[model samples]
Target: MTRSEVPSGGPGADEYDVIVIGAGPVGENVAERAHASGLSALVVENELVGGECSYWACMPSKALLRPVTALADARRVAGAAQAVGGTLDASAVLERRDGFTGNWQDKGQVGWLESVGLDLLRGRARLDGPRRVVVETHDGTTRTLTARHAVAVCTGSRAALPGIPGIEDARPWTSRDATSAKEVPGRLAVVGGGVVGVEMATAWQALGSEVTLLVRGERLLPRMEPFAGELVAEALTAAGVAVRTGVSVEELNRPAADRPLTLSLSDGGRLECDEVLFATGRAPRTDDFGLETVGCEPGSWLSVDDTLRVTGVRGGWLYAVGDVNGRALLTHQGKYQARVAGAAIAARAAGVPLLETDRWGAHAATADHDAVPQVVFSDPEATSVGLTADEAERRGLRVRAVDVELGEVAGASLYADGYRGRARMVVDLDRGVVVGVTFVGAGVGELLHSATVAVAGEVPLERLWHAVPAYPTISEVWLRLLEAYRG
Candidate 1:
């Protein structure tokens, strides 16, 4: 067998052209890209192969939100609003969510891996050394595997809880627990007010939970445009959510006996809720990955360049993609980086000219730097692409922000009756090009990609005019934005 095909050592001694740690969507994409480029790949995964998105974060969360969003959309229409009475079918919502999550199984993902000539090792893998990985199989057996070309670390991040007294004992729900929860608590207390907090709050509140949203900042969605948070908070409050901002839980304790979770707030107050969620943030899943062997710190996000090759390594044999790299944490962005990293590895192995200088090359993850898009699937969904106006100003760019009331657009009225939203365009005035765009509405998530393409492609304002948006569609909001920008 070729060196690439030979196992490194042991009973299941098998080697590969590429060894990818973590079998999440990012890892799967990396393996697929490498295999498509004629490389033998092996994916090491301890949990499900499709990673957190397929079961927990993206898939299940979206599944839970879609029903609620649909109901909200229906309620917004005059004709449909009459028929929309009563809460969601919580049991059916859970069942549908389970189906979307594949019942927490990875059978389909495994079959796809095998079909693509990529092998799977059900184990937790650690870096033994450069281009070498040691995997502890499910049966407690250890196998040493080596990659001939590259070893990619696509292990994603995990939810990070805050440092609060008695918090551990409190058993607060993380994103995983929140997304996969079958039963919605009658009273839910969500902490952090970020994407997870808001989205889960929206989901459970619609699913019949008395949701109390706690935000340490003054507003929800602190990272997005300010108005986005304001509109969402307004809607959430209107929907009976107790939206409390500038708040933090001091101490949390779940009683040993059958009692609700008691939380001590920073304002010298107390809250007792059936369940609490800590949607604070995410930390890289590298605390035990043997990063020290490669002269890197364990438990920290790996550093990588535009090509996603782990920086400061002796050879470009190491790559850290997805959430592990800390470039862009979104699933789609991680998959994009995986594609770039995979193609780079394949080209490097074949001794071909790398697309080093090409801005939009297959090897470079440029979009990760310039054009990452995000959609918050809340009622009056918030979508943004590229840099926000604040981000542009922080970067010291000469940017002009054009704000337009989305309600002014005929399409917004037609999309759903009484649709109130805002759209903003951040323009690089010197370059006369769109640098960023943000939209807040009932169904603006689908409109984000066009903005992404506009910013990513660096399509000038003049050229974008020719790409006319269809009338009487939410997309025509683009024309209003352009008009606002021109003025």
Candidate 2:
């Protein structure tokens, strides 16, 4: 049946075996998994069905960056460098980004939801009580939905703007705006040195904007290894971005809509820019969702167990996945949690005992704690899996960190004229297994799954050595890292 013919959660169709709030990737996975497990499911979404990653955060942002990365890669090779053009075509890049987002339309996404046999409710959903949700539609109507088995919250998050004076009047850009803007600004000021800040700074600078990056911290990508941030900062600086650290916007003033913005810095400095983007952080989109009805604090992140079940909820009928639970904010990790939660809900409904105690079981989201992989798609990419060296040490585990330079690797040198990168592997001394690995360089994202496998599977160093990487490829970095660890 077409999406229009699907049930809209009215009257007799208001009840289902599972009701998933926020029809993003996480919610979609949960509903599909539950439905495939012989349970009826309904997904409620007030906005687009494909959610943030499809339209704003991941897809569009990547579309903007892909051209920049492609051009930079070409310039690194001698033969290709002579054939490349001077600068990117900003209009073409914007058009390509628009294509990725389907021009901000959700028709294709809605069709996919219909194909999966899940009912769609185009409305904002709120928790009415245990197992009950109230949805407000666009046309001044409300529908109450009751779940026979579970209610999963996957509302995700929104960009958080700082509480600077005149911030509201200044009209700063968020991640959404940075990715979806129709026209490029002449001068762009990017605040916060996290992934969004650096990535956008890279994209806009290459797209013809004079970009300035302001970071409150001492370095960028502070969550990763210190060297990762250092390398990325070096690259950004070389690319014409004014990278500033240990400073923040104290106030912003835009006298009028037609004029440039004047920003007052915390370090007694002033700057002017056509536009400013606040990439500081994200806040959970849990406010005004009627969470208080079920004793959950409104606007607070939900706490969950290994099974993705909300803690302290009496009946165990409530679950939260994705950014709302604050587990792992990445889209892929959220979908992983969705699958685990769906299985747990299905098992409980069918009177089958859940494998909550088993970390590797189908119903447990063990990777949320043990192995999480993330990549910062900067000029020189930074990717890591599992714990950092500092993180493992903080957990009281005796660990040794082995470092390798990518330029020393034959494969890396062959990939580019002057390949510059670094790799680190953190080994747990007691278990003789790999606990963490980080790679900072161009095209290192492709090597993350291998590191993830080693960390998550707790692969031993001896076993890893036998899994020899193919000769003269970036994967060979694994062999070098292992050799370094042995010595």
Candidate 3:
């Protein structure tokens, strides 16, 4: 065994079949799987049980944005706008968010864990060795835990603040502060045009904030296609968001209480705001976890193989799933990886030969490397799945694509008087599969699943034709996209 610095659970006295570090969705799923396999399991978490989505990421952002979307719809429809008076209740929106997230509680989640027979430890856990964990509890007690089967890490990610001069001194708000804020900033300067920044910008803008979005890239949603960016930019502009593209913030200076932020831009322009919100990226939380003692660095994530076992580490006992593994950052994908790791651990404990593949099997991280579906729930929501045209072409796929103005479809017209949306379908001509799908428009979230299923099932173009969209629905965009594919 490697000489380890991190401690374990009393030298096998409190050893379990499996010990899951981090009680986020992924870690919870891992413990659940171990219990289902008739193995004892324990899960440790230092923060709230539901992870970022519950409080700071997905849930709160959506709650904040929903009212604006609803208000916009009402305003567009003449009779509806007239009945609803003048505006949305910002206080009510915050209250609803607080109620759903349990005000950052793990009570219900802890109860559910107990009901499922998984032990819960409210503590910070670190790796002592390959199968050992030492936890420092919030109550000031240290407990060492050893896993007889496997030790899995599922700590999620944290917001990555950009490296701008004087940024830290300015005390900028990350997704953490922004999501759980008691008061929305009157004038917000959002640095980054990624999903989180854009969503927060939309929410605050709708909540009556004078929002200015600054991005280094020329277009919004650069991870997405240019067409999608164009559509979203148009929508954001229509919603009164000031978007400054191809610009970089050179410095951040804190001002007086009345005007808090001054951003010096590469364009030699200075923008002032009440607060600066950074939504650039996310880094995996692999630090201070004792990975170094086990031949892995704390800040660097563990590299895992097809079986989700860490590479360059012996005994095949250590595993990483979810954000900690640097795989797909989505909660669902992490849970999927946890299922694989959990099952693999159980099978190994039973002396069964490990099954391995990158598909949806018991040990595959296939979804991590493929078909990761993501959605942006802005006023004109955006949903995308699989690879893009450039990605497909780069992979040497003989590719063909089709783009359709969403208005061409009957569904778009029915959704609103002047519904402006765009849909693009990228096809792998050689494999006859839909490699990608992007939908950007109002009420487009519902339209994503069909495309996801098509991509996952690799349903052929001719076969997708049989999966007819309902008449006069926004989903008719799918039918139109398919027709454009052939044309």
Whose lDDT is greatest here? 2
lDDT of 1 by residue, 75-118 (tens): 88898999989989999999999998889988888877777777
TM-score of 2: 0.98
Q: Candidate 2 lDDT, tens digit per residue, 1-487? A: 2553344444578888999998999999999999999999988888888999999999999999999989998999999999997799999999999998989998898888878888888888889999999988765678888999999999999998889999999999999999999998999999989889989998999999999999999999998989999999999999999999999899999999989999999899999999999999999999999989999899999999999999989899999999899888999999999989988999999999875649778888999998999999998999999889999999999999999999899988988789999999999999999999999998899999999999999988889889989989989999998888878
The sequence of per-residue lDDT tens digits that candidate 3 reaches over residues 279-351 is 8888878888898878987788668986678888778788888887787778777877888888888888888
Candidate ranking under lDDT, highest first, comes to: 2, 1, 3
- The estimated TM-scores of all candidates read 0.97, 0.98, 0.94
Of 1 and 2, the candidate ranking higher by TM-score:
2
Candidate 2: C-alpha lDDT? 0.91
lDDT of each: 0.89, 0.91, 0.82
